[model samples]
Target: MPVTPDRWNDLERLFGPRGACSGCWCMWYRIKRSEWSSNANAGNRRAFKQIVDSGGTPGLLAYVHDQPSGWVSVAPREDFSSLERSNVLKRVDDKPVWSIVCFFVSKEHRRQGLSQALLEAAVKYAAEHGATLVEGYPVDRLEGKKFSSVEAFPGSVASFRRAGFREAARRSPTRPIMRRRVRPRPKG
Candidate 1:
């Protein structure tokens, strides 16, 4: 389900006290770096809550046995200011798109293909919201090399691939801009 006001506590529980990474509260891509650094924990939490309270569906939540187990931040490309400013993750074209910026799964839920499932749900969510194309910036994992979970927060290229996304651009060796076209839900 989308992260609405009533589901705030479930999201908080899923993210834990660290806000899913040093107080990110999933607001890292939504705000400027300096602001994110300053806000960190409590401020970020409140800021995110305001988004939810205002009825903005910043992302979707996944549940396991009725417990919130994962999150994926998907919104209009314009919603993430940091992406427009990133050297490696800059837009691929003028075409409008919805970007998948982050993913977090509870420790116990890791390696269970939850990330791939979340990506699929994100694409569906975006399509339902009138998106013709969905994009993701996933980290390309090298063979025989392991990276920390923090580094993999954006998600893996393989996961995106499994969700039917293809590489649209690759400015960085380890970061690939992936895209998937979605037919918007028919009007009622």
Candidate 2:
């Protein structure tokens, strides 16, 4: 479900005290390198909390039997500061798009199709929230190589393909910018 204020505790519980990846708190793309380096984990956690507290729906959390099991960061492209600066992920078109920047599945939930589910959920989230295009950066993989958990946060090309996102651009050998057009719900 959308990460609202009431759901903040659920998110915190899912991320744990370490803030999911040694203090990333899912803010790697939201803040600058200087601020991120100086503030680190605590700072990023606070920043993310503030976004939630202020009624910003930064992403969605997936639940398994009512237990928060996964997370996917999906918001407008403009919300990701780091993405705007990356040449490898530069915009492929002038059309506005929502970006999927991160995914975090609990250790127990890994390798169980949670990431693909999250991508589908993200597309629905973006469409319902007024986005017509949803984009993601996924690793296409190298011959006979596997991505460690940390290296796969943005998702895998296979997952994106399974989620119906096609490659829009591939600036790097492994990194492909994938996109899917979303049809918003009809208004009453």
Candidate 3:
């Protein structure tokens, strides 16, 4: 399930004063570049608050020791226009897709595989919510190459693979679109 008001403080603490891993506050995929850069701090906070206050959950939050530890932005693909505009990440089909856009883990929570757990939770969330398909655009780095948590916000191919998501298409060598089917069984 997505984060709610009760979980906001945990999120704030998890992200700390920097706001969810380097002042992003998880705003990269939702807003345009100019706007995002300009409103990096205040605007992002306002946007996140608006989503929750309006009874909408932009993504799920992970808690460790009863404290917010991580976050991932997941929702209907169409909800994020910035994605469609990107040359790298665009619609592959007219069929609706639930997209897992970004991931952010608290500094203290890094390297604990929290991302993989959040991803698995997303699969279940989509399944429960009647999503026929869930998709993600994860980075595909060269073999043996490594990326920091921030660099892998979109997630790594290996992470999505662990979540039972398979490659559906690859528009760019470094970007592979991964997907998982969560549809309920059809009536016989």
Candidate 4:
């Protein structure tokens, strides 16, 4: 579900003090490279906290029997400044899109399909928030090659495909821009 202030503790617990892999705190795309490098760890933590404190849910969190299990970073494409400046993940079209930028699954929850579930939730959340399209930048794993945890954070192409996203473009052989159209849930 969409993360809120009430769930901050759960997220923090899932990310730990180092902020999920060297203090990224999932701020790699939200801030400039220099800023991210300097603001890593504590600075990134505070930045992410401000977003949650202000009632801005930057993404959705998945739970396994009430315990936070995984996360998928989804927000307006424009929200990720790094993507806009990315030569490999440049805009595919003028269509406004909600971007699914990152994923973090707990060690115990790895390979349990939580990433896919998180992605599904992200698309639904975006649709409800008035997004017509959802976009993702995923790494295409080479045949027979293994992907390390850090190398797969953006997500794998198969995961996006399973979530019903299609390859929209690929500037680099290993990176593909995928997208899926979304329909908002009808109001009761």
Per-model TM values vs. the true structure: 0.97, 0.96, 0.91, 0.96
lDDT of each: 0.93, 0.91, 0.82, 0.90
RMSD of each: 1.3, 1.4, 2.9, 1.2
Q: How many residue pairs clash in each candidate?
A: 0, 0, 0, 0
TM-score of 3: 0.91
lDDT of 2 by residue, 72-170 (tens): 999999999888788999899889999999999999999998888999989988988889999999888899998898899899999998888999998
Tens digit per residue, CA lDDT, model 1, 13-89: 99999999999999988999999999879999999999999989999999999999999999999989999899899
Candidate 3's C-alpha runs over 4 A off are 184-188
Candidate 3 lDDT, 1-188, residue by residue in tens: 37888777777777777776656787777778888788878778888778887887788988787777888888888778898888778887888889998888877788899999999887777667668999999999878888776679898998999888999888898898899988744322
After superposition of all CA atoms, the RMSD between model 1 and the true structure is 1.3
- Residue pairs clashing, model 4: none
Candidate rank order under lDDT? 1, 2, 4, 3
Q: Which residue pairs of candidate 1 clash? A: none
